[model samples]
Target: MLKAMVLRNIKLYFKDKGMFFTSLITPAILLVLYATFLGNVYRDSFTSNLPDGFSLSQKLIDGTVGAQLISSILAVSCVTVPFCSNMLMVQDKITGARKDLTISPVSSAVLSGSYFLGAAVSSLLVCFTALALCLGYVRTIGWFFSGKDILLLSADIVLLVLFGTALSSMVHFFLSTQGQISAVGTLVSAGYGFLCGAYMPISSFGSGLQKVLSFLPSTYMTSLVRNHAMRGALAQMEADGVPKVFVDATRESLDCTVEFAGKTVTIPAMYAYVGGMVLVLLGAYLAVQYLAERKRIYS
Candidate 1:
């Protein structure tokens, strides 16, 4: 029964062609912006502070900036894509489908699980496709990632997807109308990237703003992806005779190493923060479900 419900939700999500493609609009827009002029902006930043007569290869610079662009897309997509994918719950409520399910043999717990699992799976599919396309683009510019880096990146995507789905599920439970969901989705797509440091480096913000962003799980998740994506390019810069100080500075500036309250956050700490948030959000969703079930029983 659980499996069937999960499958049905997935089918419905994909069957709507408009919704399926709309989930990808955020990433698509970022890609177009990069190709048009964002690419040059990143390239100039890479070379802006070089010592006189010190030069890096164009291929290396392109590869580095390309990695940063893809990482930002991945981070933002984890949230925005899930926001679209999880709308099935809101649709079910608005269309009376959820009430229909309540009369069936399927338990409310299983129904809720189906929506959660369906959203996670659907979002994962779209995010993986985006990752593949971004990697292919990076290869054309200059491929630097090793086998291990790819494996780590895949793992990062899974973690972020789970986090995204849980967060979206909690929010969707309160959204009873299509208008509410659409408005919230638009707001998230517009603001989440900046809040998470995907559109601009957190280090560029004022100290107070940086400290506030540090408390967000999305911020750490973005840093994790950026760290893996840019690892190879940063190493290649050192091998190409760039000074160690310059390489370290680049890493910090790009947010591959994030700071919180005057302390550098390690990679393990980033993973721990995201993982903890996922667990907390899932627990909160279950609590809400239980409370809603009790209300239904007493009413």
Candidate 2:
């Protein structure tokens, strides 16, 4: 029954062509923007601080920029895409479908799990497609990633998708109307990239702003993706004789490692932080679901 419900929700999400494509709008816009001029901007930022008489390969710079672009798109899409995918729950509510489903013998837990699992699966489908395209683009520019990099990135995307799904479920539970979801989606799509240091590095901000952004789990998520995506490029830079100091500085400036309270956050710490937030958010959603169900029964 749970599997059927999950499949049904997935079908509903894809069957709505507008909603399906709309989920990709933010990533699409970022891709276009990056291709047009943002690519050069990032490249320039990366090379602007080179020491006197030092030069790096244009190929290396392009590869690094491509890697950063991949990280940015993945980070932003992890949240925005799931926001659209999870609209299934809102659609159910607005159409009276959820009430009808509840009247069936299916347990509320199974029905709710269907929504979460369906959204997570749908988000994974979209994000994985984006990852493939990004990898292809990087290859055309200058491929630096190893097979292991690809594997780790795939794992990171799965973790991020789960986090995004739980977050969307929690947020959408309170939204009973299309307008509410639309408004919130717009707000997130427009601002989430900046907040999470996807469009810009947190290090570029003032110390106060950087400190504030550090508290956001999405910031760490972005760092995790950036670290893996750029690992090969950074390694290549080191192999090509770039000074260690410069490479470390680049890592910090590009948010390959996030800093909290003047301390660098290690990769494992990032995973722990994001994973903890996922559990917290999912638990919160389940608690809310229980409360809502109880109220419905008593009222």
Candidate 3:
């Protein structure tokens, strides 16, 4: 049943060639543009402001870390994944497909799991393709270590996709119409991404805004990117001519931080941030399911 549902979804997704291209190709294009245009800007920004002693050259050379952060950011905050996921749900709702599923022999768990699985696959493709584009651009412009960082980055991308899928599930539940869903999804996602340090540091915002940003899932998504990419980059910086004070200062200035895999990870505090969201989403799913079942029985 799960297989059938997944296959059906894959077919439907491809049948709409426009949607397929928009979902997969748009992000890759954006990543290429950002890496090509902003890569150097970030490099320059890092170099110019890199307090008095750090090796800006090595940080730039750490293309793996940069690619990871950029790719993950593009995947999580850009609204493409959430937009697509919400659209799928809205389509199902509008056509009465979701209502049909509610009455079908297939369990609710299977129905929800199938949709989440399809979204996960779609998101994974976007993230991988975006990273590849970023990596190619990174090679052209900077010094990036492509070995361990690549593996770590790939793991980070997978986690971000999972986090995105879980998040979209809750969004899918609340929206009553496609237009409303799309508008809210885009605005909320883009706003959170920007405010969560995906494109810039959340700390750059006023303190109140930063505190609110801390609750957002994207904050942790950025944290995962930082831990995966910038952790090594920072370690390398410390080894190079960067002063301890400057390195410490840079770490302190980070928007979020985490400790994972027996290492003290400093990026954005992505784990705690996403964990909170996941818990909330799980609770929402349960409440919706209970209400749905109760309505079905009582009515």
Candidate 4:
């Protein structure tokens, strides 16, 4: 049943030529464009902007840059999935497909899971391809690496996909029209991208802004990826000019440890956020089902 749902989504997605290109081919092309032409220019420009005395390793800075590019690119793809999925949902709702799907032997869980799985698979491929391009660029720049880093990077890509899936699932039910979904999802994704520190350090953001961003799932998701990619390099920096205390604090913060920088901070609860989002979306699905059932009875 899951396989059937997955295949159906894949087929439907590909059936639209414009969406197919936007979701898959567009990111790949943008990555190539950035790496081949724009990346060096952007890096040099950004590096020049940094003031002296605030030190960062080349690897960490580059990792952040790469992450920005990947996250920016993925943000577009993220909206694309929900935009398409919600459009499909809206169409189904109008055409009685929602009622039909609700009444089918497939449970709401299975149906929702299947849609999420399909989105997850597509998101994973796009993110992994983006990561590969970033890593290849890193290798070309002569950054250190191990087999373990590659494995961890792949795992983070998978986690990012799950994060995106959760985000899209949460947003899908809130809007009925494709245009509304696309507009709102794009806004939300952009907000998440900023809040997650995808383009800038959350630490640098004002305290109020950071506090607000703390509730966002992407903040945790992006930090998870950035930390994993930079962990070894950050560890090595401690032996160099960076203070051991600073490195320890950074490591502790990234590892989700509470004690950092002479303060006991409670770790942000990403799992709870994901669980709450799942329940909210499930409730929404049930609400829509109930409405459809009542309409049928009344009609």
TM-score per model over all chains = 0.98, 0.98, 0.81, 0.70
lDDT of 2 by residue, 1-299 (tens): 99999999999999999879987665777777886778988888778888778898888989998999989999889888999999999999999999999889988888888999999999999999888878988999989999999999998999999999999999999999989988999898888889999888898899888888889998999998999999999999999999999999999898997878888889999999999999999989988998888888899
lDDT of 3 by residue, 150-182 (tens): 787787777776766676766776676868876
Residue 31's C-alpha lDDT in candidate 3? 67
Could you tell me the TM-score of candidate 2? 0.98
Query: What do the candidate models score in CA lDDT, each in turn?
Result: 0.90, 0.90, 0.63, 0.58
- 2 or 3, greater by TM-score: 2
Clashing pairs in 4: none
The whole-model C-alpha lDDT of candidate 1 against the native structure comes to 0.90
Candidate 3 residue pairs that clash: 61-143, 61-144, 63-144, 220-270, 223-268, 256-268, 256-269, 257-269
- Deviation from truth (RMSD, Å), model 2: 1.0
Native-to-model Cα distance after best TM-score fit, residue 165 in candidate 4, in Å: 1.9
Ranking 1 against 3 by TM-score, winner: 1
Cα shift from native, residue 33, model 4 (Å): 7.7
Q: What is the lDDT of candidate 3?
A: 0.63
Candidate 2: residue 245 lDDT (0-100): 95
lDDT, candidate 4, 157-210, per-residue tens: 665566556556656655566577568756764465455564455666766776
How accurate locally is residue 130 in candidate 2, as Cα lDDT from 0 to 100? 84
